[model samples]
Target: MNSSTHLDLAFTALADPTRRAILARLSEGEATVAELARPFSISQPAVSRHLKILEQAGLITTAVDAQRRPRRLEAQGLAELSGWIERLRESWGYNFRRLDQLLAETAPALEPERTGS
Candidate 1:
């Protein structure tokens, strides 16, 4: 998929608090569905649904370990998102700098007012 397409999926998957929480947990280490489901009161199926969405978005991926399918954070997906955000921040910073320069040029210098003693 294209970058925009991946970003769209990632943002949509991240919109849910539960999914975000899941990602946070996976950030620490890979976990089985049961391990991930323990923090929330939700059912295993519900957690699996969230996991499916996350996997679809490329934010997480599964690995086979014996009979367990553990999920872990995908660095490429996170890095893509981070890079996009950093580009935005850099653009905004440049615009702010330009604005400051313009304001400095147009604004009059402040002079101290003397009070009669």
Candidate 2:
């Protein structure tokens, strides 16, 4: 798990479609800047800029492979995002259970009393 601010940064990084696409590409495996940018019609520098943001957010990491810098997905970042989402889901589950209990408890109160009809 990570701090809220870091999680926020990761969320912000994922907000851009290009960055998201970049992450999606990294998910498959590691690739150099040129390889990553090949699918898009943007310049290599443009891709680098997006990669910088992703790297800052801890979503991706770069490795120096001789003449190339290969980028790959970071597990810690993915885990942090997954942890936040799981917490949210658990909280919603608790809330729904409480609501169900409340509804069940109130059902009898709304029923009319049956006389000797």
Candidate 3:
């Protein structure tokens, strides 16, 4: 999928607190659905639904191991999201610098009005 689609999926998945918690758990290590469900009050099936969304967003992956399927975090989706955020941060940084410069330039003119000049 393209970058925008991938980002959309990642953000949508991340919009849920439970899904974010799931990702946080996976970041520490891979886990089964049961392990993932233990921290929350929700049922295992509900946790599984969250897992499905995360997997679809490309934020995680599952591995088959006998009777269990363990899920782990996938870096590619997160990397894309981080990169997009970095770009936005840089743009905002530039804008802030320009704003500071503008205020500095206008400061002297405003001083006279403050003195009732």
Candidate 4:
């Protein structure tokens, strides 16, 4: 996928709580579609759909083994996600610091006059 499409898929895949939970489960170890579906109240097909989204996002992979297809988490896409978040955080952090400095510099000028007559 192109970079923008990859990011769009990654964020959209993560937007659902079920998919996020699936990612968390996969983080522990690889699991079959049935195994992943077991914890949730949703049907196996629904879980399969979530897996498909994750796979399309490049967040997970599956391999066919006998009767089961085991899904495993892939780190590269997650690393890219983390990098994007960190860069945004850093940019905002710097801007906030600059704002704080400007506020500090202007504070004295905004002080009200104290007069006794």
Output the number of the TM-score-best candidate: 1
* Cα error of candidate 3 at position 109, Å: 1.5
How much lDDT does candidate 2 score?
Answer: 0.93
Candidate 3 lDDT by residue in tens digits, 1-117: 998999899999999999999999998999999999999999999999999999999999999999999999988878889999999999999999999999999989888544555
lDDT of 3 at 8: 93
Candidate 2 or 1, higher TM-score: 1
Alpha carbon lDDT at 77, candidate 2: 84
In candidate 1, stretches whose alpha carbon ends up further than 4 angstroms from where it belongs are: 109-117
* TM-score against native, each model: 0.91, 0.89, 0.91, 0.90
The list of candidate 4 runs beyond 4 A from truth reads 64-67, 115-117
- True-structure lDDT of candidate 3: 0.94
- Kindly provide the TM-score of model 1 when superposed on the true structure, using C-alpha atoms: 0.91
Local distance difference test values of all predictions, in order: 0.96, 0.93, 0.94, 0.94
By TM-score rank, best first, the candidates go 1, 3, 4, 2
Per model, state how many residue pairs clash: 0, 0, 0, 0
RMSD of 2: 2.1
lDDT of 4 by residue, 1-117 (tens): 788899999999999999999999999999999889999999999999999999999999988889878999989989989999999999999999999999999999999988998
lDDT-best of 1 and 4: 1
Q: How close is candidate 2 to the true structure, as a TM-score?
A: 0.89
